[model samples]
Target: MAWLVSTPSRKDDTGDRLFLEVAAEAARNERIRAIYLDVRAQAFANISRAFAGLMGSDAVSDEHRALAQAFMLIELGSVCARTLLNEPVQPASDRLIECLVGMPV
Candidate 1:
């Protein structure tokens, strides 16, 4: 769920942030929670795989490897949050992508 993270901000009729409003709505819905849980589980599995791959690589420096793992966790949280709101999955920002791929390793 990258769309929500990338979406422009707006104010709701109640003058509250639209993103917060949507998040609150999702929080109240059981179906949305279920979907979020499922997605979160999958995200964690993916992160585990990536971490394992990184651990096996001798080329990656410890600091950069740790950063990469942290980045995966951050991305997982972001995706799960967006999934809770049923947002479309969009590509992550180019800068973030670059950091994930180009970080000294």
Candidate 2:
């Protein structure tokens, strides 16, 4: 999956705006919050699929599910930190990717 390595160049993060918008809406709007929760579950499923693809497995393994959940949390944190600081996700995101490679999933 492209998302596995889809970190944008720092200056070209066009997705950040929409991410912030969704984050704000989820914080205050109950309907959007529910939808966002569903979206997050879907994201986790998507990530599991991606990880399975990487492993050349047709089904997502337990290890894949664990790694996907961890990676999702890291990604969400990276986005939040970037939006709050008005900066690019950097070394932290890079570091997370590195961890993924070494992880046994």
For residues 1-105, could you state the per-residue lDDT of candidate 2 as single tens digits? 445645522333568768779879999999999999998889889988878878778999898898788777777777777776776677667677667746765
The best candidate by TM-score is: 2
Local distance difference test, each candidate: 0.48, 0.75
Candidate 1 Cα outliers beyond 4 Å, as residue runs: 1-24, 57-69, 76-105
Model 2 weakest 10-residue run by lDDT: 5-14
* Per-candidate TM-score against the hidden true structure: 0.37, 0.76
Q: Per-residue lDDT for 11-58 in model 1, tens only?
A: 122433343455466699988767666765575555445544554653
Measured on C-alpha atoms, candidate 1 has an lDDT of: 0.48
* Candidate of highest lDDT: 2
